[model samples]
Target: MDHTAADDISHQANAWFALFHGGAPTPEQRAAWSAWMAADVRHAQAYAELENLWAASALLLQPSPAAAPVAPARLSRRRFVGLGLAASAAAVTAGAGTLWLNGVDSPFADLRTAVGERRIAYLPDGSTVEMAGHTAMNLDFSATRRAVELLHGQAFFRVRPSAAGEFSINTQAGRLHTREGEFCVSCENDAGLVAVSQGRVQVLTAGQQTELEEGLSLSFSARATGDIQRAELAQMLAWRNGRLVFFNEPLLTVVDALQRWRKGRIFIMDKQLAARRVSLILNLDHPDQMLDVLSRALAVRTTRYTDLVTLIYPA
Candidate 1:
């Protein structure tokens, strides 16, 4: 099959998997799903891959007997499926390989934050890093160079002025170089974002280079670069102040941000609802109210299957 056909099948498989995984399906829904599964051999294959991936992830993330007692929660199925899709995309080339390791738990990450947790790190060179919840990054510093590779999630960097060399941040999408500035970098949905709060920084991606001054922001991916646009510095950096600000942003984006600050998973099962635009500011201090707030704001209903799993749909 061609790439587009493969992607369509994958998406359909994921949607069906999510419907069944969220909770017990209605008889009609189950019948529909069964028909879909029986319609194509490739559908069964894709879904089987999802099941295997989920089983492996379950084993990998399972807490040991010695682990402290905590409220019951499961890893996000949505995230696992996303990982599978990404790996599949990378494996499109013949002879390519894929590794299904979680970035936040990877051994190579020098620093990481847990769900609903934030941390500040002071580097040897006097630079400061403020990591958001669920963020992970690796540090490579030497006498000649200072570098950080953001494996996933988000972090704000304040580079200490240095004549030695420019501090660099590496994300899957691109690289950012800066000196004597404060900026934030976020990696989400296969894209990287850089928003400058102070001083100037340079972004390089897809064989193109762009310079961003204070109050400017840009987003890039492996294959494309975005235009520099003026940014709302306060809103963009609100997480540092224990807030999340969204202005006419998609529900999918908001849900992704909320996932970082809370335990467990939040899934928008309805594609139309996920694409709905939202504008709101939320306090990160009270993550427990997230679902209720979203339900109220968007006129949706939230069903909690387990302490860890919450699914959103039209009211």
Candidate 2:
């Protein structure tokens, strides 16, 4: 293996993935990445390889690895992850590279689903949580209380009767209180929407409270809570079964939901175009064709820059 040459390109590919995954990137950065990929066929291949690497890691979301099968030394779960990423680094020992990743573990043992991934985690008390893609949350269970915080993204909670005192999802907007219920909460950009699929839950926002039974949803933001709306969330769960259902949903909202099950970013350069409405069913198995369906229907053109970024604008 020619170490020196491929190392620079692979590291650049990973850096581009990190930049695109972070908060919105400026036009210059996007253009630079585009040009970088266009410079050499190898650059494009390196990026494509990275995207496939992420898509192939669905197994990691299965359950926390008891222990890495390869390395002889003991390794914590987080360090193991950094060690995997280190495999793509230039010329360095994985052990030395992961020293920093070890000290950076979340205080409360945060669980997350990467882009294009979903996770099912069974809690200590028999309760289960289903996390949507690009989601992150933390669990803090004690004898007196059981609570999980949705730092970002969406999660479905299946509360167990004998779990503890109370099972609730805490957010900056407010608290979603439930007991022995099946509910979903999606929190993003300082707001959230809660829906009940079974049993009951209460949405406590600000000083007011709203009780929700099966087949109801409440949308709340950091500032105020909206009226209880009828949300067929069970349909949205189609991702679990390799399908996504959309009915008269805003184009931006649809894109946001679908983006979770895919790698990279979808930039709606035209804000007005983002407001267009879409109604369709997308197959999760072939995530790429999702953009195809919308592009043809809305007469909007989708220009995909490899697998790392997609651009949607009026055709």
Candidate 3:
């Protein structure tokens, strides 16, 4: 109602939220909280407001290693960033407080396609997002944060960085900061891949960060650390140009690329066949045709089921 009342409510709400993160409260503290809950309707309202703040602030709340209360002076920078997000969330919740206290709609919220679907999206910030096959993501941009939540499948991002802002790809593992790069992110629930084709990018997980430059790749798994490996530039990036270039590349890797382009699967009967290096350019448009060309070029026999699946074996 009044400024003092609002400030008090905000302070109490923040305190309670801090307790929630600090760990389970003592029975005495719990009794106090319960008594406070019944003290007045405004107390309940303020507590609910604080819970909204916590949800809006989830992005900032990294788990403390010791599970202890984080002092105000020791609050991480991420918490400060979360403060801005919390304000934004506050704005959205002012009217429809009943609704989840979240930021505006995701950029990829409306992005989808049918089976064997593909669409290209040009973001407002001049970056281009190519949704490969059946992919989805939500795009959210504000003064402080530029982010996209990859819902499923794969998407290649040529991010146009803002001079004064940070662009991040938020997945289950954590946030990836793309400073300047042409990168591809393939996300399937808990496991994901972040490959940088050019420039540089940073992957943030838990409290750790990894910087990946051009020709570098990293795979992230939920509840575990990630592995950083050298990336083959041509094969990792060829999809952008509608071709997959394999210069003495392994057959297995080539088959994996074909799988992404089409719906079916490619099975190699001989494991030694995977060691054989084959140099060829496969057009993504017609995977079956590529198989036929491979068959001719490598003396391999390919058996086909539907247009979506194929198997390659030595002739």
Candidate 4:
């Protein structure tokens, strides 16, 4: 256990896993992998450390540790890749060096989720809120501004707009004004996206204003001066179906979307799966059925280590 070489191998293992989990390995990478495996058990041990680190991180992104678990089944390659990315991102943000155990107290006590989880709530204002996995929202509808803070993840709002009142959904980025109709807004960090499914929404910033009509969508990054990206009709409001709808979206992006509602993770075993195009209606209420359909459609296998964990690989 030489400190210098063990530490070096450990870092290299992390890098290798990053690339390996990222895509198909090159011939050289495959060959080097064999040599590394033969060199010593430490190389394998080091890689295991990285993998364990990532797996632990998936828990942090969950909406709540107490949330129900998804049924055990196989996951798709695309879902697997998606979980890897989510775990990596969480590891970086939550400080990979820290140790966290299950059922530990969390500051996000207000709301949380595992992976691929979903929850619904009845609002004080007679509206309904369906919170996506790994998402949080806080309500502080003050006299000046009716605000629903988008802390993280995503949420769909069916607002009962009052005639004498205006509803404003607030995120770290800014505030959204909602009138008599239904809308949904997702916020992450200093950026947020808004979609109007049935009514109109006026998004207000420091000095700019944009309005979305029914069946339209837009994205706003948390920058002092950021422009908005107009969203397509069906693409923007796809969540209404209790599925993460995508059309030609990157595998990485789609996984991120699905991770929002379930307890189990979706890990990609190979990179080739990432580039393949998939079109399926995901039923959040039936995650297992969704996985089964995905496995057959994509020619992959879903392995469940636990009700809360899953990995996708070539069958």
For each candidate in turn, the TM-score is 0.67, 0.63, 0.54, 0.56
Cα error, candidate 1, residue 15 (Å): 40
**CA lDDT of 203 in candidate 4?**
84
The clash count for each model shown is: 0, 0, 6, 23
Error of 2 at 122 (Å): 0.3
Candidate no. 1 TM-score:
0.67
How well is each residue in 1-315 modelled by candidate 1, as lDDT tens digits? 998798678657756765575457899998998898899999999888767754543343334477564443454788756644553454221110212123244455789887778999998789999999888888888888899889888898999986659998888898899888999999854588899879999999878999999878998998999888766565577688786767568887888788788775566666777788986666677787666666756788877645545667789
Error of 3 at 163 (Å): 8.0
Give the distance in Å from residue 3's predicted Cα in candidate 3 to where it truly belongs.
Answer: 70
Top TM-score prediction, candidate number = 1
Q: Sort the predicted structures by TM-score, highest score first.
A: 1, 2, 4, 3
Query: What is the alpha-carbon lDDT of model 1 when measured against the actual structure?
Result: 0.74
Please give, for residues 25-70, the per-residue lDDT of candidate 3 as tens digits. Answer: 8999888888877887888887786455334323223333665632
Expressed as tens digits, the lDDT of each residue in 104-167 for candidate 4 is 2234545554445567877666777777656666776544545576667677788887653877
Candidate 2, which segments miss by more than 4 Å at Cα? 1-109
lDDT pick, better of 1 and 3: 1
Candidate lDDT (C-alpha), each? 0.74, 0.69, 0.62, 0.60
